[model samples]
Target chain A: MSSVNDIQNEIIEEFNILGDDKESTIFYIMELGGKLPDFPENERIDSNIIKGCQSKVWLTAKDDNDQIEFLADSNTDITKGLISLLIRVLSGKKPKEILDADLFFIDKIGMGNIIGSQRSNGLAAMIKQMKLYALAYQTKQNA
Target chain B: MSLNVDKIRDQFPVLHQEVNGRPLVYFDNAATTQKPQSVIDAISGYYKLDNSNIHRGAHTLADRATRYFEDTRAAVKEFINAREDSEIIFTKGTTESINLVASTYGRKFLTKGDEVLISAMEHHSNIVPWQMLCEEKEAVLKIIPVNDQGEIIYDEFEKLLSEKTKILSVIHVSNALGTINPVREMIQAAKKWGAKVFLDGAQSTSHLTIDVQELDCDFLAFSAHKLYGPTGLGILYGKREVLESMPPYQGGGEMIKEVSFEKTTYNDIPFKFEAGTPNIADVIAFKTALDFIREIGKSNIKNHEDELLRYASSSWSEIKGFIPVGIAKDKISVISFNIREMHPFDVGVMLDATGIAVRTGHHCTQPLMQRFGLEGTVRASFSVYNTKSEIDQMTEAVSKIAKIKNK
Candidate 1:
């Protein structure tokens, strides 16, 4: 399994190749949403939904063999793609590893330029939610 | 006579700009109209020349600033055809203006079992203020139901009015749907029960001609920002008699006539409501914005905006998966729609990528959205400065976005 840094670096290189055109970047991001595994319909409830998002996003997590896996979905395609990127970098890692993970690739690939200003809040909220799941798993592990 | 769209667009300096490698197509006029060059200059000019606290000032700049600020109230009084300049008061924005009435007028007049009626399509500001008032006064808040076409049911509104109805406040033109309420008739009906009428003219004063005398509304609130002026400055036009009946909204230097530890006397009508140091520069600049609208004339501006809305609705209706949120026959300055299988936020982002600005989300009209069985719609509002070419660009971009999801 690749380290978190190694995964972020790989993702950054791919996004760098996508160039700086906002339209293309957004279109590419929407296209990337297709990479996410199908989100469970049963888990898409108010409790699972993240607050402070313009678009509705439902996030869930599970601990498998002491490794935390994050699952997320959004009503909007671009937001879905954004969460998929988070999942790509941080999923299948131990709780401590996920919690301590620094998402430097967000700035490196100029994700802010791609997602626009309003979506930046949703992206931040999503990252916080992912880390919160990791913290929950880490707490469970300690118990 | 029709307006010279090119000339009008040229007057707004902000229109001549690029966004994301494309010429910015600003269609978010309902949120806040872009300031014209004259309005912008007026703001800077005030700071450069006459920057001083208004009213009760002995200095030269203070007197000039005071005169200019009062001149805006006079201009607004004429623009809305108010009975007197003293009837017009300046607040921060439409939200504050509404809150002022709710707090001042509603607090004094309302009592147990009394009703404050509002329509379903009102913005959150309009609704929340009254809701807070109703909750405090032990009054019942009534909503006039809206039809599927996003218009308030006239029959329902009439039925909602009763002797217990103390005030009937409603939006003149819906920011979310652009439906123009028959406020003139509504005001006439409201008077039968002796209910004061407040028109949330935040969207109307820009696109429509507002003659407060003709409409007979007791109060009208609108923001200067939506009228191509500055933000953080709003006008509250109240009938002189009605304004005098209400108590002071805030306790501050300007709003008070005399102060003491035991007894305090408040100023008259407009000043009674206007508290603290006002938004002097913006208020002065607002006259220029109103002048910009006056020079163009409402009829000419309406014709251009109606043409834009007509072209956009017809153009976008042809696209697959295009669903219009509001289809009120008497709508103006707004076209609300959504693409099938796509969230409004997504469509808004896609349009922004093409430098076409549109408003998404609930538009602060959550109840209205719920009434339509929608979370939100993409609202493309037009101003006098908007052109058909801009609408055409938006149409193409929307069609392209729709195709992506529908396919």
Candidate 2:
């Protein structure tokens, strides 16, 4: 299993080649989302939805021993790509590790310039939700 | 006379830039129109030379500021053909203007069991204020439903109107759908039932001619930014009698005639509604926007916009995945649509990459989107300065974007 930083570094390296061509970059993002595994339909309830997204995104997680595995889906392909990137880096990690993980890839890849202001806000919200899930599992473990 | 499109485009400095390494094709006029050089100059010029608090100033700067500010009010009176300058009340924008009426007029006048009639296509601004008013006053809020084409059902509107309706507040032209409502007839219909009429002209003031005395709406609200002026400035034109009847919107300096610890007497008509320091530079700059419109003339502006709409409407069918949302027969220059199987946000992002600025998402008319069974739509609104070439570029770009999903 790759560490969170290892995956983020891989993404940064992949994106650096596509550099400055927004059309190619956006299409690549969408292509990545196309390859994401289908999220469970039953788990796609309003309770699982993340707020602050212009497009609706459903995020659900299950604790596997000490590691948390996150499943996410979005109505928009670009938003799905964003959440999928998050899932790739943070999923299958211990709750404490996930909570402590630094998401430096978002800034390094210039996500703000690429997604515009609104989607950047949604990306921030999705990260917050993932960390909250991690915090919940951490509390359960402590208890 | 044909509008000098090139000359007009030259006047707007913002239109000359690139968004994402491509020349900008600004099709988001419904959100807010870009300001001209003259309007920009008017704003900075006010601050540079004539910045001072008006109405109670005892100095030279105040005198100049006061005169320029009132000149805008007078210019607005002429622009909308309101009876007098005193009838025009400056507020934050259309949202605040609507809120002012709801809070002051609706609070005092709206009673239990009375109906505050509005249309389903209203932006949240028009709908929320009435909803809040109804909740507090024990009044009922009635919505006039629109057809599949996004035109209001005239017969349904008539049925909704009754003796119970205290106010009939409706948008003159829908910002999302671009539907040009038959508000003149609706206003006339409401008048017979003794219901006050308020027209939200945020979209219409830029596209169509507004003559308040002719339309006979009790109140009309619109924003300056949408009319090629600055933000933070809007006009609320209430008939003198209607203005006199309503209580003050907020309490502070200019809105009062006399104030003591014991008692405070409010001012008259426009002053009673305008409280404290107003948006001075923006209001003054708005007059130049008004002048800009007058110099071109509304009819000429409409002619160019109509052509752009016609070209756009006819050309969209050739694209594989184009599905239009609002097909209203009487629309202004807006086209709201979706690409088949692709989300509006995705379409917007792709188009933005090509330097096309179109408003996506719900456009703040969530009920209208619900009515159409849509999450949201991609909206392209045009102005006089927009050319057919820009429309062509957007169409080609949208075609490329839509094909990515279709293929």
Candidate 3:
């Protein structure tokens, strides 16, 4: 399995190839979102809701054999794509690896340029929520 | 007479700029209009020349400032054709104006079992304050239903009206859908049942000719920013008898007559509601915006904006998977629609990339969205300065985005 940094670096390299073409980058991201696994309807409740988003987003996580797996969904295509990118980088990783991982690729690939200002705050909220889930799992593992 | 659209566009300096490497096409007029150069100049000119606190300062600048500030009230009174200048009260904006009525008029008039009737299409500002008032007074809050065509069902409203209905507050034109309500007819009907009528004219004042006497509405509230005027300024016009009856909304520096700690007499009608130092500079500058609109003539501006709305709506209907949200027969220059299976926010962002500014989300009218079974709609609203060419550009970009589904 690739390390978190290795996966982030791969994404950075992929997005870097797209260059300054905003439309193509947006379409590419949306296509990735379309490929995300179906999130369970039951889990899309208020408790799993991620705030600070213009569109509704739900995120859930569980520890599978000490590897954290995340499932997320958004009402908006771009937001869905954003979560899929995050999940692709951090899912199936150990709780400690997920918690310690840096998401510098977001700025490196200029994701802010594509997501716009308002949704950039939403992207930060998604990252914060995921890190919180990882921290919760890490605490449970110690016990 | 045909309007000179290019000349009008030249007066607004912000229209000349580019947003994202493309010339900006601002269709978010319902959210807030781009100020004309004259209005901007007037704002700065106030600070440069007549900068002083209004009313009480016994100085030369103060007198000039007071005259300019009160001049706006006179302009607004004439703009709306109110009965008297004293009937007009200045608040922070439409939201504050509505809150003042809800807290003061509602507190005094509404009692248990009294009903406050609002339409299905009210913005949150109109809905929330009444909800808060109803909750406090133990009064009943009722809604008049909106049809699929995005119009109020008159029969439903008639059925809902009763002696128990003490107040009827409705939007003159919907901010989200651009549905122009029959406020005059509704106000007349509500008055038959002895209910006070208030029109939320935040969206209408810029597009329509307003006559308070003709409508006979008990109160009317509107914001300046929506009318190409400066922000932080709004006008609330009330009937003389009604204004004199309601208790003071806020008590502070200006709103008091004589304060002896134990017995503090309140000031007269307009000054009684204007609690503290108002947005003096913005209020003074607002007269320039009103004058600008008058110079163009409201009817001429309306004709130009109506033409744009018709052109855009007809062109947009040709796109595949296009779903127009509000298809009211009578509307201002707003078009709210959604491309099938595309989130309104995504469409808005895609439009923004092409320097087309449209508004997305519930537009502060979540209940209206629920009525349409939608989370939100992409709204493109026009102003006097907007041209048909800009609408064509927007429609072309929207058409391209809609084709993304086929890919």
Candidate 4:
């Protein structure tokens, strides 16, 4: 599997090429969401739900061979696409790497210009949830 | 006489600015209107010249402040055509006005098994207060169901109205759907059963000509912000008898006549409800908003907005996959719609990129959203200052967004 930085670099390169066209960037993000694998229906419960999002997002994570894998789904296409970006860059990485990653690509890609302020808050929320999952896994492994 | 659109637009300084790269197209009037320079200046003027605690102050500034504060009440009294100035009570906004009624008038009058009737199109402010009161008093809350077009079913409302229905509180114009409810007819019907009627005029005050005597609604509540006034100020109009009979909402400085450990007496009708220090500056400046509306005339403003609504409704209908949510025949200048398979939030984001501000969501009416089988809608509501060209810009952007699906 690719490292988190490698995936982030790839994303940054793709967004940079997309350039100042906000619409195309949004469309591309939504397309990425459409490509996300179907999250298990049984795992989509209240416990996995992310709070403070305008749209409902369910996220579940698992620890496999010391790597963290995250699965997420959102009712809205743009929000779903947003979470897919997180999953793609952070999934299949060590919990500590996932926690420590700077996520510089978000700013480099001008994600704020596309998502607007409120959705940026939702993006922040998704990041927080992912970090929480990483912390949970790190605790379980230590115990 | 037709309103001078350019001259009217010039009054609002906020409209002259740019958002992002384009000129701001503010279509979120239903949420809150941008204040005119006159209203803004009035607010600043109050602080500059006559800033003091109102009601009882020995200083000269106090006398000036108290007169200005009371002048707004008289202006509001004339604006709504209330019989007496004492009937108008100033609260924070529409939410506080409704909460005050539910707490004071509702709690004392309503009892177990009594019913409180509300329309499905009510804002959460109107709904939640009654729900809390119902739970507390063991009263049943009945809703007047709205049809697909977002108009209330008058037959259903008639059937629901009975002696058990103690209160019939309905929205005069729905903030979400823009449906102009038949409150006059509904109020007349409710009075037949000896039920008290309240009208939530948050959306209506700016759009329609309100003569409280003509409608005969026992209580009318609205916010100043929606009428191109300052925020944090609202008017709750109750009939003199009703205001006199109800208990004071809160026990505080202004609401009391005599206070002691042994016994305490409440003040007069309006003072009894307005507790503590009110939103003094905002309330005083709200008179300028009323003056602005009166100078334009409500009918002329309505005519201009109606033209915009008609033009927009017809123009937007041509767009592909454009599904209009609330298509009531009689409505204010508000349109709630969705493109098939497109989320309202995404539409809002795209619109913002074009410097167009539209409210996208349930708009604090979740039950109404549920009734329409929608999570939310993209709502574009207009005011007097909005232009046809702005509507053109919005529709063109929306058309392009809708086309994204086919591509």
Candidate 5:
């Protein structure tokens, strides 16, 4: 299990290599998409689908013994990598932890500065979908 | 063409610049045309000489401002050959103008099971607004289908028009495809069903001669930026009776005659649609741009641009794997195409490296892209100032890019 500090280190290192420029960051994300883990057929469903995306994206979160985990895929290669980066920041936490987490980590990841308007918009849509999932999980747990 | 190409080119200061170690070849004219020196001077003169809020004030500056502001309305009325200046409403570009109608006019007149017809080749601005209106009104949104060449199938459109068709909002010229729509025929057919027709004139206003009375469209919308005027200003021309019938789009100053606590009486025709502080300087500057067009004459400009288009189409056709996207029998100067083995973005970037600027995207017509099964196209749209020499340069750049990508 990776600690929060460990994940933070991974993010920092990854961002350092990608640089802070928007064009470079998009290229980096596109490269990252080439290395993303594939999701199984059963994992691709409605809870994962993101609206307002030009590309089709599916993200699934698994709650295992109070820890949250996620896997995502997109038909668009660059968007797939973007989903992967999001999963890295958002996955592997409890529902409460995910709900409490600051998604502004995207700014720290340099995604806000590094992508084109459309790609950045797609990222925003993905982040919204992830946050919604966390909120739904919290509500279900509370209920 | 009798127009001096060199002299005309010199008038636009922005054109005399170097980008990436080469002279900038601006082909993004369909998206927005470059403003000439005269238009720029007119804009500056407005701010420096006559900077004041229009219509209401009695002060010296206000009187001058009001005169200049209202002068633009008169210019627009004459430009489109509308019956009166009262019919011309100034809004924030084509998108806002379209939305105003969908929200106000559509809400008032349309109901469940009614139809609003649009073409498949419309910009997302035209498509989304009506779709939203359809959702709210419980009306069905019908599409006038386009052929593979991006021309609307007139037979299909004729058959689609029915008594239930309340409105037919269509583009006069498709920004993405460059297809010059048969708007006169469309207006006649749609009118037979007692449907109001709105023409999206964003593309056509710059390229083609527009006479709203001649076309007989109930409403027409166009942007200043696309016509080589200032941005953030557009005209919405509606027939007096239709505009009077629709309620005011927003509640604000200038749009209302008297705002009491109990009830508010709206202002007449155009003012009822224009709310808040209008883009005064830009609106006034638009007169100079229109004057520039009038001086050149629309027919001469079209002929010059058509010559450039003919050169580009014939030259670019020679390149291997180069397929032009929109090939309607009647198209304006917009040439949208894709090269095999090259992504539209890659093609755009390559062209930029050679100082050629072309819009490489869905051109804000994603539904049109979806219809063609393409993500985007490399769009090289022309204007009055664009020369055949520039088209030759573009063709050369595209050919080189295609070869490099193919290799």
Candidate 6:
């Protein structure tokens, strides 16, 4: 029931003290990616595909009771983990709720400093894509 | 290996430093070569002394800056053996230069059903712009497929050339694969069909000797960074006639002769394409880089790089379970390889720990990586400053990593 800001705050808290070392950061991200909720098969296609990212992310959303539930999977180990992190904040929320999630919370989470420029850009792209999904879902729900 | 490796290394201030607790081994020359102190000084000196905008400035500083900026253009014209200084246009980099032609020339000249012929081994920069252009113009993008050895299939390329072919843009050297394309032959063939050719000289400009007159390409594009100049600067060499004919890419100050609320005339050839405040410092410093290359002589640099490549090939190839990519007959100093059962990133990390800077992953040629059925490759590209001893260290480190990872 929490807004996107709350979810972002939770993500920031979760990312606290993820180490400065590249290997450590990678390991932490991998662990985070592994913990993401499983996505439904039916909802996965077209819009979920990310073009430039090194990771293969499959995103799916379902209306879980009254809330929006997101299931995201990635083939690349670290990237899959990134998908999991996205799911934590973005999943099990309403379309408007997810859309309202504060992206700037990444900096508070210490993930901003940890991730490379490319990965950060990828994360931003991921957030954007997910928001678009949420917007689409909201439109569909209204329809 | 005629280059005084020690002296050359000393010239590059960045190369002398330590990274990750080890002496830096810069093999990421393909991405961007480390600039020498002379180049750095030149850039700083320009800003320090003559920091005014060029062409229009009546002041002493303005006149000096303008003279130096145009001098680089003159130097670039000689560097590529272009017809005139006006033929060389300053761009942000090779990517921008290619996009300028693809957008402007493609828009003005090419129509529906006109074909844009490109090689299969092209970088994404070369591929995507044309793809965008083709989509916009309803034109066709026909690729000249590579052979097993990663060289272009000459027969296939020859067959594809037709009256419909409006443009043939190809990489003079494949960045990912290190395959030196037979652009001369391809350009000659394309010329028969009256097709204009744009050579992506991003990789070749650093290693191979380029003579636009000799290659006879309509346009040639390369970045200064790859040639030991500062980053954020590139040269776009186009035939004066062809450049004059094409519409300007950007509309702004410097690129225009007259600016009004009504119809405005464009500036002459080079400036017509170069819009806004140019990367003056980097462009001026690039003259030194060009001069540096000329002093070394292209053949000598090629010989040294070739030797290093040969040594690495012999040494690294012998490592158990080490798989080398891009075994083209004609190549510059790029060596892309993967180890058995080990991720390229892991290998890169291990190499980086030893202070060896190598590029990992698809190298921005994801489509090519998909074509090769590879996730990524650990790339060790060489320059004049790199040594056999450095390669030996790289070999030892790679062998140990492969053994540990595979086991």
Top candidate by lDDT: 2
Interface RMSD of each: 0.8, 0.7, 1.5, 2.0, 6.1, 4.0
lDDT of each: 0.90, 0.94, 0.93, 0.92, 0.85, 0.84
Question: Candidates ranked by lDDT, best first?
Answer: 2, 3, 4, 1, 5, 6
Worst 10 residues of 2 chain B by lDDT: B398-407
The fraction of reference interface contacts (C-alpha pairs within 8 A across chains A and B) present in each candidate is: 0.73, 0.68, 0.41, 0.27, 0.00, 0.00
Error of 3 at B352 (Å): 0.9
For residues A1-143, write the lDDT of model 2, one tens digit per residue: 99999999999999999988898889889988887789999999999999898789999999998999999999999888877889999999999889899999999998999898867888899999999999999999999
Please give the C-alpha DockQ score of model 3: 0.60
TM-score of each: 0.97, 0.97, 0.97, 0.96, 0.79, 0.80
Candidate 5, B315-356: lDDT as tens digits? 999998898998999999989999985568656756776778
Q: In model 3, what is the error at residue B304, expressed in angstroms?
A: 0.3
Comparing to the true complex, what docking class would candidate 5 get?
Answer: incorrect
Off by more than 4 A, model 2: A138-143
CAPRI class of candidate 6: incorrect
Residue B194 lDDT, candidate 6, scale 0-100: 100
Supply every candidate's count of residue pairs whose N, Cα or C atoms clash at under 3 angstroms.
0, 0, 0, 0, 2, 3
Task: List model 6 lDDT by residue over B1-407, tens digit each.
Answer: 37787888888889888765567899999999988888989999998998998888789999999999889889898888888899999999999999999999999999999999998778999999999999999999998887767788899999999999999999999888899998888899999999999999999989987899988999999999999998888788999899988999988998998888898999998889988998888888999988888887989999999999999999998999899888999999999999987668657766776778999888878777877888989999999999998898898888877775355
lDDT of 1 by residue, B52-150 (tens): 998877999999999999899899999999989999999999999999989988999899999999999999999999999999989999999999999
- Candidate 2 lDDT over residue span B33-65, tens digit each: 999999999999999999999998899999999
The DockQ for candidate 2, computed on C-alphas, is 0.80
**lDDT, candidate 3, residue B27?**
95
- Could you tell me which residue pairs clash in candidate 3? none
Interface C-alpha RMSD, model 1: 0.8
Off by over 4 Å in 4: A18-24, A110-113, A140-143
* Model 4 TM-score relative to the real fold: 0.96
DockQ of 6: 0.11
